[model samples]
Target: MQKYPMTKEGEQALRDELQQLKSVERPKVIEAIAEAREHGDLKENAEYHAAREQQGFIEGRIQDIEGKLSNAQVIDITSIPHTGKVLFGTTVSIINCDTDEEVQYKIVGDDEADIKNNRISISSPIARALIGKEEGDIVVVQVPAGAVEYEIDQVQHV
Candidate 1:
């Protein structure tokens, strides 16, 4: 399997989630299964079936998180030198050339990308367009709606 780039925060978040699943969720499911078993008649036991299904989902998620954590290359943005160029883990402020509206986004790994939080994946069209570009540079990105132009106003490593 190929390794993927991830922010340090993203890696830690995944680890924390995995820990919760294993330490808290797994034990809760086990107890639920035990309680269901005591009721007898497993063939028609709805609680038992539901508990088993939930266990399967929790286990699958735990494995997925473990795999992602193992393959992650955590990048610490704070350690890098700020050169005013758009790079991974850099927070970029941009102005829509047409509307002159300002938008800020933090370029992060795929796992950490949340539009509501203003965090974008490095693989996203906007981030791809901004990568390697410096502040005051204008970039045109091809989006599903059409091509959009943005001017890089500032770049900060946080």
Candidate 2:
């Protein structure tokens, strides 16, 4: 089984979602299906069909989260001493060499990557280039828009 590298927060988020799906969504769907069954005519029961479909989705997601958690290698970055080097779950500050714009991104697992929240996947090109590099290092990343150079300004465990 491939181990999924994730931060403590990422693991907690997945566990929380799994709990919600199991305790809340699963029971709600089961109740809905039971209520729909009382309406009779299983052949033309749209509510029943929709409820069953939703139950399937919730169960699938629960299983997926369980599998991920079982294979997850949760990393508590705060437990490690900061070395000013970029690693998985570390927040990085990079300055654009071309536009002189600065941006901060927290390198996280694929499931936790949200660009809007400044979280980037470890497999992304920029994150790949940033990994193993230290502060003050200039790294070039090849994106769809072409090659972009970014100077590593800071690396934080938080």
Clashing pairs in 2: none
Expressed as tens digits, the lDDT of each residue in 1-158 for candidate 1 is 88888999999899899989999999999999999999999999999999999999999999999888888989998898888899999999999999999999999999899999999999999999999999999999999999999999999998
Q: Give me the runs in candidate 1 sitting further than 4 Å from their true place.
A: none
Clashes of 1: 0
So what's the TM-score on candidate 1? 0.98
Against the true structure, what is each candidate's TM-score? 0.98, 0.98
Candidate 1 clashing pairs?
none
